[model samples]
Target: MAESSPVRFGILGCANIARKVSRAIALAPNATISAVGSRSIEKATAYAQENGYPSTTKIYGSYEAVLDDPEVDAVYVPLPTSLHVKWAVLAAQKKKHVLLEKPVALNVKELDVILEECESNGVQYMDATMWMHHPRTAKMKEFLSDSQRFGQLKSVHSTFAYLGDTEFLENNIRVKSDLDALGALGDAGWYSIRAILWTTDYELPKTVTALRDPEFNEAGVILSCGASLSWKDGRVATFYCSFLANMAMDIVASGSKGNLRVHDFVIPFKENVAPFYTVEDSWFGELAKSIHPAPSEQQVNTDLPQEALMVTEFSNLVGSIKGEGSKPEKRWPTISRKTQLVVDAVKASIEKGFEPVEIIY
Candidate 1:
């Protein structure tokens, strides 16, 4: 690959989420769609055409064909969770950087195998947690880190949910046991868990306790769930995710000196700007009748959507490895693994009759 050329991406599936990611690849200044592949060549072709992929983009009938393409520098994998380990490992083994969708694997054991392959093959690995690339997220981190204003973190809460229609509940891959079996936990809770981990600077929680019984479909896929996480220092966090609630994405973090809140944590309400609220040293009035000051709202603007930024960042890392002879970035895979570990712990807690599961890592 030339240093000045955009990173060439090979999409491994025609999953619906891949449509959005294909646009992100095209929008990213450092990346371009090189190929799209699926079990059906017609579907792959249609996906490429419908997504406005460049005319030069190749369509392949099988994922292996995309992997074997010498021009492809990276792969965007949007396959279901059950298929992630197999395709992701193969992509890495083929010397292609991997931009995998969330719930990277069925469990930590599977994720470890994928990571091991990427590590051995020296290919960059990043999950499609687009919001992490948002400038608003960075701004929120700055506030959380401010000792004088935000002070020491005390607790955090996150929620992500969207009411699913009848068709979705009956036939969506998310509700299928053989597909995204982790269900709503893997779909929506992934973001909530990631948010909690991010606020704590990637620190592993001491324990996880699933809240009560998780609602599941007939196929045994989770449809709604919540969990509580605790740290040795008494810092605590809670999160809820569902496919049966009104759409909502929120995160609230309280600290000794201040508090922070974001209603749109997974995807911003608007593509151009994102807003969050915070209040420092909130206190009662002299008469103890009311709070002293209102929370201040802050907005962060971006020219490109967060998903595009995610692609740009991942492509830059791939370019560094391909063009500049740099080592794969460990930060991304580390954070991804941490997030998965927490997710696995929560699931374990739920399976153990809501007993607190101690996190080892």
Candidate 2:
């Protein structure tokens, strides 16, 4: 990378989600999409053309070509979970910073392999959890951390679901056992698990118990599932994820002194501003004397969307390592691994007759 140049990104596999991240990379001040690769040259070329990729962008027929390109500084991989460990590790081994999609791997063991590769190669690794980069997320956390208002956490409930029509259920890769084996638990539940972890300040729960009513598809892949996580302090969190229900992504956290509610924690209804509600100590005995209603605490505003912010943040990290000789940031991969650990525990609980599975980590 030359002085004052943007971090050039090479996109691998051209998944549908790549379109969103591609636009984000183009919009970010410190990032640019240098190349896009797929299994076929026609698809790569046509995708770049149809998606409005810059004329300067290179098109490659194979993922290996993108990784071999000397002009590319980093890669954004939106491949299926099954392919995550392979491509992510390869990207790191090639000395390319990796911005991997959510549900980083099928298990913690796979994630550790990817993380080790990045560490050994001295490359940055970040999971593409766009909401974490949002300005609203930080604002919401501030309230939860405030002792005067939120005090101590008691319980949290999270829900993420969307109706999958006839076409998606029968044909989508997520429904395939070999592609996204965790299905709804991995796709939608990952967000809920992350939200619970964030609310608890990244504390690993003592145990995880599946809700005992998980629905599976014909291929034995999960379509709907829920899990309960409990901590030693008696703090409990429950999350529901599904592909059979209407669109709903919500979080309700009740603490000793106050409560917090977010209607859309995964993706806000509006792109520019996100709102969260909070209520503190209040008393009620009569009809209007004791009952207190929480109002929107803040409408967090941002100049760019969360995905663009994510791209910018990742680019800056890559730039620091390339320009300032800074070591790779360890915070991101560490969180990603912790998130995967909980995911694995949830899967185990579901497999073992929905019994409570202790979280060793």
Candidate 3:
């Protein structure tokens, strides 16, 4: 493949989330949708038509055909969690880069297997955590990294929730125990956990403790849950994720000398611009009447949506590997593993009667 060529994407399965990713792949300057596959040719054709795939895109009845297509440089896997390990591993063996959806696996053990395959096959691998590629995220990271602006971190709090209507609760694959076993924790909490880790420079917490009284469905899948993560230096991070609450995606972190807050950390309210707040070197007035330093809002603007940026970034990495013989990025898989480890620990804590679980790493 030429270094300047766009990475061709082959989407596996016609999942709802794939609708957004399909658009991202098209919008990305360095990527294109080459094929789509489903259980039936009719379904695949319908999906391609409904999703506005280009006429050049091929429709395959089975996922294997997409993987077998020589024109496909990569495959986007948005299949159910239970099917991830099987298909993702096969895709890697087939020499196709993988852009997998979040909650990468049911557990870290499963994720390791997938990551190992990608590594051995020398294929680029990245999970679809769109916010990480957003321009606003990078801007906020710049602010957080500035010692003069945001000093040593003290605590972090995040909440990601959305009210799932009755139909969605009953019909969505996320609530199905056999499909998405982690449920709300895997769905909403993945973002919250990622936010915490991102702000903390990808540091794994020392311990995790689940809050009491998690809500669950009849099939015993978690519907809502919260947990606290603590580090040895007294830094603490708390997150609440649910499918039963009103829509909210927030992150608030306080440092020794600065505070940072963002209302929409997962998905921006608007596609083009995102906002965040910060207060630095603030001090109470002489009479304790008011603070000396007022909080300021920072808005980051982008021409492309965050999801598109994600596709562009992933495609760039794919291009590098194919054009320059570069190794796959290890940081992404490591971050995914850390997030899953915390998730596993929180579930363990909830099952152990809210006991604090010590994280070995």
Candidate 4:
């Protein structure tokens, strides 16, 4: 990667989620999308032209070419969930900082390999669990940690679901490929666990029980799942993830004095939907809409994509690397390890007729 003025980014693939994050990257204060790579040169060139990028913003016919490009300082890997670790290690080996799509890897072993590769190559890497960087999530963490308010929380309940995407379903990437490393567990459950762990800072669970629909093939890709978590600290969380359901996302925290519920836990709306010009605005208003509003310390509300926040945070981490900010911590490893524990527990439970499996982390 060349040392340009601002950080230059090359996208590994033109996946749809990559488009969503490309917008975020464009909005990022310190990043630039210098190139996009696609298996098809025509697709890459078309994406470059349609996205209003400079023609010099190279459109490579192969991912490896993009990695070899001198102008690309970082790469966003939005490839299939199965290929996350494979390409992430390659990107790091190419000396490119990576912002990888979630579930970081299919399993604990793959995640470890990716992390080890990044460390050996001295490249920064982050799983794209953007919401943890959101203001609301941080505030929720503070509120949960407050001994006076919500002390020693008993349980966390959360859900994330959506109607299956037409193309994704027909092609059945969710059910067919090795890249389909997980079903709802990898897709939505990751966020539910994120909300629970990030908010409460609980030790990873000791046990998990999961049930899935038989037709889903891989136990990970289920129409719906119900799982129970027993954390090491005696705290518990119950979470659900589904692909057959309409978008109904929620997270609830029950503590000693009061309870807090996050409606639309995944995507909080900032601006109300408009007739013709529906802008994707901030989520503050929606987040604050029906707060219980505790007397002494108020509940918090903010709507921001986790990706944007995560990117900003990563940028700060990079600056810190250059002695421009506080040193970054090994947060990604912790997050990856805990998330994989949850994933493994769920898979084990489903395989064993919903038998409870102890959480190793």
Choose the strongest candidate by lDDT: 1
TM-scores for candidates 1 onward, in order: 0.98, 0.97, 0.98, 0.84
Steric collisions counted per model: 0, 2, 0, 9
Question: Global lDDT of each model?
Answer: 0.94, 0.92, 0.93, 0.70
* lDDT (Cα, tens digit) per residue for candidate 1, span 1-361: 3357999999998989988888888888999999999999999988888889999999999999999999999999999899999999999999999999988988999999999999999999999999999999999999999999999999999999999999999999888889898999999999999999999999989999999988999888899999999997989999999999999999999999999999998899999999999999888998999996899999999999999999999988898888788999999999999999988988999899999999887
Clashing pairs in 2: 283-290, 284-290
Cα TM-score of candidate 2 = 0.97
* Weakest lDDT window of 10 consecutive positions for candidate 4: 273-282
Best-first order by TM-score: 1, 3, 2, 4
Point out the higher-scoring one by TM-score: 1 or 3: 1
Candidate 2 or 1, higher TM-score: 1
Off by over 4 Å in 2: 1-3, 285-290
TM-score of 3: 0.98
For candidate 2, lDDT tens digit of each residue in 189-292?
99999999999989999999999889999999889999999997889999999999999989999999999999888999999999889988856757765576
Best-fitting candidate, measured by TM-score? Answer: 1
Q: Write down the TM-score for model 1.
A: 0.98
- Candidate 2: residue 44 Cα off by (Å): 0.7
* Native-referenced Cα lDDT, model 1: 0.94
| Alpha-carbon RMSD, each predicted model | 1.2, 1.5, 1.2, 6.8
- The Cα RMSD of model 4 versus the native structure comes to 6.8
